[model samples]
Target: MTGEPILEVRDLCVDYGLGDRAVRAITDASLTLHRGEVLGLAGESGSGKSTLAYALTRLLRAPGVITGGEVRFHGRDGSLDLLAADAAALRRVRWNQISVVFQSAMHALDPVARIDAQLTDALRAHRSGLTAEQRTGRAVELLRLVGIDADRLRSYPHELSGGMRQRVMIAMALALDPEIVVMDEPTTALDVVTQREILTELMRLKDELGFAVVFITHDLSLLVELADTIAIMYAGRLVERGPARELFEGPRHPYTVGLLDSFPALHGERVRMEGIPGSPPALTALPTGCSFHPRCPFALERCAVDFPPTATPAGGSAVRLAACWLHEGGRELPAPLARSLGSTL
Candidate 1:
């Protein structure tokens, strides 16, 4: 295994249109994921969590274009630039070097094709050296690995339950033994029971395989259990990043604090979870200075007019840094922010 990161995304930006009024779906978002680590990108809708994941896959749809960034993949074949990968290179790299478990696994599969064919497509595309017999054996092994019956591989997608179909998607993702896997709301469409069960299975697989994971979800609590590091995004920008414990234990940014509040814990008193005021701002017309200031309860004049420089300790990285005014002046986060972050959990 390379000592370098399995996936390194730097200064990545994705935009729509060609001019000043164009919307920036993601802006200067950067993160590094090492093998066996899970980096959770958490936020509300429009936080650009899903957009960034799709960007790494080079699967950006129309009205979504990558404006800047380098997605570097370090793998057995060698390091490759995802942003610059051509059709052939992308084919070789995708599924083979890295794979994505899309949110809607049932939808991601071909409705017209049998499950076996879907899994075989990836195996054939990446591991074509395998004979028909070899591919069939491997396909069944994969189905069993994801906890699905091997016979289900011959069935059509419509024949399986939602959770079973999701398992098949994961099985297909693992077909080539990719070093990194990106999961976008992996259990969104399932019931709570199924979601928990699926997550349990995913965690087990994660520990056993040692592959890195970029887990994109709106649920902060879920991330706490799954992620090694967590980055919170707001209005297309990363507001804060840190080890999961540090970020949850002491969230510096008001937005981060609000997110924690929004999800009241089952164990805690029924404190009112105040949702952040107003919807996310239009990307084409972003608020000046701090993008989160307009909705921030702790916002000050400087916060609205001047962007906060990143603050850090002498050694750095003890707590992942953030561009928030609250962290300045060697002060602790405000009482409300602290209470919001800690009242539960």
Candidate 2:
């Protein structure tokens, strides 16, 4: 986390569809991923976590567009605005400087192709002048890096387990040794134990390889354990961002609080699971002020009409930032909200 940021996203905005039909999937979402650091993106579905990742890499299709903001990649060569990069430049950046592990690793892979071919194809595209032997060797090394044996490389996607498929996707992502990896819910369908193992392995690999990671998931508890920092999003806006443990222990935004409440404590006295009321608002017609206000218990009258500005709390966490009216004008939070935050339940 001490190293310089490998990727810097500033005022990044994304929209889906065209003209009046366009819905804002992400608005003013910004984040920085330092070299070798793991930054977790936690939000409910439709909060634009995956959209932000795809937008960052310029992988959006016809309906999805990057209307505003910049995604800068500061790699060993230099800094480049990814949004403005032409196809040729983008090809050089993808998998060479940055790579992505799609949501469904099984589906992401070519069912017809063996694991070895998929891994080598990435190498062949990016790393030119490599002989057959060299490519095969690199493929083996990559599989090994992800805790997969060389024998599995010959196996087809169907022959491998879900975890193996995920690791294979990860292995392919790391084939070029990119400085950053953007993963979109890479552990979605795996069992709990397998999910934990994969996350642990991913962190270990990140540390060893010295590559930053933008890990997106709906599981806040997993993020708290693996990410160095966590960013909580609601209705496409980042409502809170801070170190993982601090945000988990004392979330500043009501949305974040509700997300935490949804998960049961692993060690402490068990508490009833409480889900956030109502579904996430439709992007086509978002609320006027703070988007979370409709479901936020602490919402004040001002929250209905005025969008809250991002502010650091009075106590001043090292890098905590919350966009909420409670912190506006340096005002202390209402006693009830503060009291609720302090309570174990």
TM-score of each predicted structure versus truth: 0.93, 0.96
User: Please, what are the lDDT tens digits per residue for candidate 2 over residues 1-345?
Assistant: 548888999999988887988888999988988988889999999898988889999998779999999989999889999999999999999999899999998799999998899999978988789998999999999999999999997899999999999999999999998999999999999998988889889989988988989999999988987889999989999889988877876777888888988988768886678778888999988999999999988888999998888777655486889898887675677643353323443
- What lDDT would candidate 2 get against the real structure? 0.88
Model 1 over residues 121-175: C-alpha lDDT tens digits? 9878777699999999999999889898887878998999999988888888888
Clashing pairs in 1: none
Write out the backbone clash pairs for model 2.
Answer: none
**TM-score of candidate 2 versus the correct structure, residues matched by position:** 0.96
Best by TM-score: 2
Highest-scoring model, lDDT: 2
Which ranges in model 1 have alpha carbons more than 4 Å from their true place?
1-4, 313-319, 336-344
Residue 267, model 2: Cα distance from true site in angstroms: 2.3
